[model samples]
Target chain A: MTATDTAARMLDRGVTPERYARGWHCAGLADAFRDGKPHAIETFGAKLVVFQAANGEFGVLDGYCRHMGGDLTQGEVKGDELACPFHDWRWGTDGRCKQIPYARRVPLRARTQRYETVVRNGQLLFWHDPEGSPADHDLLPPELPGVGTDEYTEWFWETVPIKGSHCRELIDNVVDMAHFYYVHFAFPTSFRNVFEGTRATQFMESKGRPDKAADAGGYGDADMVLTSEATYYGPAYMINWLEVDYKGFVTEVVLINCHLPTGPDSFTLQYGITVKKPEGLDDKTAQYIAKKYAEMFGTGFLQDVHIWQNKAPVQNPLLCEEDGPVYQLRRWYEQFYVDVADIAPDMVARFEFEVDTTKANEFWHEEVAENLRRRDAASEADAPLEGAGH
Target chain B: MASFVPTSEETLADQRLYTAGWLTSVSCQDCLAVVGVQKNSAHHTSIQWSAEALAACPEMGRRPRELHAGCPRLQASIEQAVRAGQVPIGAGDGF
Candidate 1:
C-alpha cells in the first residue's frame, strides 16, 4: 500500500503509536536511581537505562550496548562509566565509547543513544524526541516547599497499568469540566482553562459531598470549596495542585502523574503524592497529617482507573458548551502528534482563554506563568534562524 | 613598541595585512559579503553566522536550477570553503 493508504489503515485500526512532544518524561522518583547502579525504564517502546554518575548526575541511554547488543543495566559501573556485561566495552556518560578491551583503538563513531535527563521536584525526568532533536526548553517541576527535606515527608507513589488505553484520553480529562459533576460527583462553582503551545492549565473550583472528598482527604460532611489547578509540561506529564477549604481548616496536596505508553494500546500511569506540613503544628502531628493526605489523594486518583480502562477511543467527541473546552484541549494536544514543522502555525491558532485566578493561589497561576516566560525565552534563543539567503 | 631598523640598504618593506589567529574573519569572494566571523582563545572559541548570508549566496541552488538560477562557479567556491574547515553558506535549511 502507499504511504497515505498505510497511514489511514493504521489510524482506522488504532494501532499507531501516538507521537509524543519533545520534553521530559518522568523516569521515576529522583531517589530511586541509586549511585553506581543502572535502572531499566520503558517509554515509547524504547528500553532506556537510567544511571547515576559518580558525580551525582543522572543520565538515560539506550538500554542495549552498542557493541553486540548486550544489556547495559546488567553491566558493571566504575565511577562515571559503564562496562558492557558481554564484552566489557566501557561507555561514558555522554554515550561515547571510552575503552574497548583487546582492541588497539576505539572506533570514533562507537556510541549509543543518550537521552537528556533532569531532576526537578524530587522526580527524575527523561527527555525524548523521535528525530533526535535536542531539548529546546526545560521542564520546571512545581516549586513545592519541604520537598526532599527532613522537615517534610517523602513522596508516596503508585503505578496503575491500564490495558488498551492511550495517554490522549487521560489528557482529555483535563478539559472535561462537566464530568466533575456527573462522573466524579464534583459540584463545579467556577472553571476555566488556558492553553499555550506545549503548556496548558486547568483551574477548577468546586463543591463535592464527603463521599467524593473522602478519597481526597476532604471532610465529606462539611461543604468545602475545593480549588484545583493542573499544569501540563507535555502530553505525558502533568502536575496538579489541589486545595481544600472548609470550616476554617485548609489542606493542600500536589499530585504528579506521568503516563508512559508501553505499547500501541497500553500504558502505565505513575502517580505520586506529596503534602505540605502546616505551620505551628508539631512534628508528629504534621507528619501524621501529611501521611493521611497522601493516602487520601492516592485513593481518589485510583477511582478513575476503572473508567479509563474500559473507555473507547473517541477521536472527535460531540462536545457541548458545558463540556468545557474539550475541543480546544484536543487542538493543543494535536500539535504534539503532528509534524514538528506544523507546531509554529498550530501554536498561532491555539485557543486563548481568560483564566480566573481569584479563588486560586499564586501556586496555581503565578508560578506557571513565570515558568512559561523562562521557557519561551529559552526556546527563542535556541530556535533555528529562518530567512531567505538574500 | 620598539622596532629594529633595517640593517641592509637593499631591504624591501613588505606590505601585507596580518590578522591575529584568534580573530579570523571570512567573507564570500563572489559577492564580497561577510560570511563568518569568530573569536577564539586558548581555551574557548565562539562563532556566529547569519542565515541570510547563506540564502543570499549567489550560487545556493542546484545546478541548472528550475526554481532559481545560480552561478556554478560560486557553488564550487562554497564546496571548497566547506572542505577547508570554514563555514559554508547554504540558502535554506530545506525545511
Candidate 2:
C-alpha cells in the first residue's frame, strides 16, 4: 500500500483512548503487602495504598487521606485501619474514617475511595471500574491449579515498568500465532484461539529451535516440545499453563502475565511463575528451578518489550490466516473498555479460530535448518585454529 | 486428495453466514468425511473437525490422540479446495 493509503487506513482505525480498562489489576505479590505496613502504588493515573490487617485481610484505598490530603501509605497500619501520617486519622478498610486523634467525633462522610481487593494465586489484585460499578467476583481469575500446594514452588514475581506503549499491545499477543516463531523462537505445530465472554484463550503446541533459544539465553533445547494453554481472565490478567518436555524431562509451569496501566502511554508489567516440583526432587532444587525458569521467562518478555517500545499502535492490523483472530480478540477485549450497556453482542459472542499449522511447521523447520547452518558456519569461523592452539 | 469438488456460488454465499463464516466445509478426498476449512493466506489453513469426521478419517483413527497433529490427507484436500476457490481467504470475505 502507498503511504497515503496506510495513513488513511490508520485514520479509519482511530487511536486507542487514554483510558484504563475496567477489571481486576494486580498490585504485586500478596506476600509483599502482608507485612502490616501500607504499600504505595501508582496505577490507573491515580495513587493507591495497599495494606494488610493484623488478621491477614488485605485492603486497597486511595493513597491520599480525606482530610488535608495526606499520603496514607506513608502512615502506619494500626489493627484493621491505616493511620494517616499527616494527621494520624485512622481509616478503616471499608474506606470509612474510624478515628480522629484530636476530634470528639469523626465526620460520618469522611471516607476515601476503597477498591475491591481479591487475592488469587498469591497476587493482590484490586478492582477498577471507570463507571464505579461494583466488582463481579465471578469475573475474577480463577485459582491456579497447582499453586499453594506441595506440588509447586512459591510464586516468583518480577515487575518491570514499560514505557511508550499501551497495555493492549501485550494483549494482542494472545491471537498472534506467528509471533511464536519470529519473536519467541518456537515453531508452532498447532495454534488455536477461542474468545468467549470475558475470557480469551490461546492453545499452542510448538517445537523449540536451539539456535534461537541459545540467543535468548539458552532456555530451550531443539528436542523440546512446549505446549501451552494461556487464557486472559479479563483485560489485564493472563494465566498460562505451560508444559515443556525435553527428552522426557517434563516440567509443568504456571505463568501469570498481568499488567496495570500507570499512564496513557505506559504500564507496569508483572509476571509470576511457579514450577511444579518433580517427584523425588528436593525442595532446594525445586526452588532453584523456579527462579531460573522465572528469569528465562523474563528474558522472553524483554524481547517483546523491545518491540513494544518502538512500534506504533495499529488498530486495523493487516493479518494473514496464520495470524489467528486478532480482530476477534480485540472485539472481545473491547468489552472491558465500554460500559455494560454499550457492549455489543459480538464482543461477548463465542468465536473459535484455529490455524492449520501444516504449512507453517514446514516453513519454520526450513528456517531453523537455515539458521543452524549459518550458526555452525559462524562457530567454525570463530573457532581457534586446532593445530595452532596446540 | 489433489482433486477439488466444485462448489456453487450459492453455497459460497451461504457459507458467509455460518457460525464460523471464514470456514467452508470440505470433505476429505480419501475418507469423504467433511471438515470445516479456511485458508486465511497462502501459508495458513484452519480446519475444524467434528468427532464424527475424526472417527471416519482412516488415518486419524489409527493414530494415538497425542500423535495427531492433523491428518495429511485432509490437509491436502483443504489445500486443493483453497486452490480451486472452494475456501475463502482474507478478512471479511466469508463473514
Candidate 3:
C-alpha cells in the first residue's frame, strides 16, 4: 500500500480524541475518603481533592489552592475546611477562603473550583461537565437495593487502571452478546439492549460452563442460572443487579461498575460487589461467600481488560447479525461528549434491540459439551497408570 | 419433594427441578438413605435430599444444618452410580 493509503487506513481504524463525557463519575468508595483526610484524584487532565468534614459531610475541590497553587491534598483538614500546605490558608468545602493564618485579610476573589458530589450506595460520585455547567442532583442514579440493610454484606471494591484504550471500549460490551461465551465462559440464553436519554441498559440471562461454575462454590449446582440487569445511568456509572438461582435457593448480588477518564485514551475502571446474606448461613460464611463472588466477578472484568489492552480501536467494525445494536449505542453515548445545545435529537431518542440467542446458544451448547468431553478425556489420560508403582 | 413454595418472580418453579430429569434415586451405602442425584458435567453435581434422608444419614444428623456439607457416603454412592451407567453424565436437556 502507498504511504497515503496506509495513513488513511490508520486514521479509519484509530479512535479520535474527544472531550470527556458530562456526567457523575465515581471517584472511589465513600469510606475511602471519610477518614478526616484529604485524598487526591487525577482525572480529566486535572487533580481533585476529596475530603470529609468532622460533621460527616463530603467535599470535593480543585487540588491546587487558588492563593499560591499549593496542593491541598498534601495539607491537613482543619475543622470543615482544608488547609493549604504552603501558607496554611484554610479553604471551606464551598471552595472559598475561610482563613489566611498569615494575612491580615482574605481576598474576596480567593477561591477555587468546587465540584458537586454525592454519596450513593457507598460510592463517591462527582459531577464533571466539560462546558462547566452546574450539576443537576435530580439526575443522579437511584439508591441500590439492600445497600445499607443488615441482610447484605459490606461492599467489596476493586479498581483497575486501564491504559491505551478509550472508555468507549467498555461501553461497547453493553451490546456485544457474543463476547460472553468467548471471553467470560458464559452461555447467554437471552440478551436485550435498551437505550434512552442518558441511559443504556443490558438485560441478560446466562448459564455458566460447568467448570467455571464449579469455581463459584455453592453456585456450582448443575441447574444454576445467572441473570443480570445492568444499566448505565449516564456515561460512566453502571449498576448491575444480578441473581444466581441454584435450583433450591437464590442469591441476590449487586455490582457497581464505574469509570473516569484519566486522559484522552486512558481511564480508571472500578467495580464493587455486595451479596445478600443467604438464609440459614452464618455472618462469617456469608462474608466469605461474598468475597469469593467478588473475586470471580473481578476475573471476568480482567478478561475484558486483557483484550482491550492488546486491540486497536476500531471505528468501523465489521459486525454480524447477532452483534446487537452497536451503532445505536454509540449514537446514544455521543450525547455526553458534546455540548448540551449541540446534542442531536437522535442521540437521546429511544432505541431498543433484542438479540435472538437461538443460533448462538446452539453453537455454544455444542462447544461446551466438546470442551467437557476433552477435559474428561484429559483427566483419564493423566490418571495414574494401573500398578505403576508396583 | 420440597414443600417450600417460591413466592417472588425471581424464583422459578422449573429451575427447582434437577437438570437430569431421568436420573434415578441412589441410596447412600453407609446411611442407606435414598436421594435423587444427577451429574450434568464433570464439575456439576446436584443432589436432592429430603428431611427423611437427612435424618437417616448419621453423619448429617450429628452436624448442624449450616455445617452440613455433602455426605461422603452419598457422594461415593453417586459416583458408583455414574460409573455403572445408572446416572449418565450430560443427559439433561436444560441449559
Candidate maximizing lDDT: 2
In model 2, the runs with Cα more than 4 Å from the true position are: A1-13, A218-220, A381-390, B1-95
| Model 2 per-residue lDDT tens digits across residues A1-390 | 334322543222245565678898899898999889999998988899999987778889999998999998899999888999999999888788989989999998998899988888888988999889998898999887769888899999999999999888899999787787777777778887766678888888887666665455423446668899998988999999899786787899999999988887799999999999988899999998888778878987998999999887665465445557766677678788887788877677555576767777888888878977887887886642222110
Candidate 2, lDDT over the whole model: 0.77
Quick one: best DockQ, which candidate?
A: 2
Per-residue CA lDDT of model 3 for A275-370, tens digit only, reads: 999989999988887887787778889889999999977654544445666656776787888789888665665444557787778887887779
For every model shown, what is its TM-score relative to the native structure? 0.66, 0.80, 0.74
Point out the worst 10-residue segment of candidate 1 chain B by lDDT. Answer: B11-20
Q: Tell how far residue A45 is off in model 3, in angstroms.
A: 1.8
Scoring each candidate complex against the real one, what DockQ results? 0.01, 0.08, 0.01
CAPRI tier of model 3: incorrect
Model 1 CAPRI quality:
incorrect
- lDDT at A221, model 1: 23
lDDT of 1 by residue, A1-390 (tens): 333322532212223444555567888788888767887877677787888888787878899998899999888786788888999998887888888988999999998999777778888877777768776554455566766776555687777777777776678878775555545545555666656557777777876543333333322222566788888878788888878665557877777877777766677788887766667777777667666666555555555666677876644344222344554576567666656765644342323232222333233344435744775677876543222100
lDDT of each: 0.60, 0.77, 0.75
Q: Which portions of model 1 show Cα errors greater than 4 Å?
A: A1-18, A142-146, A210-224, A348-350, A353-390, B1-95
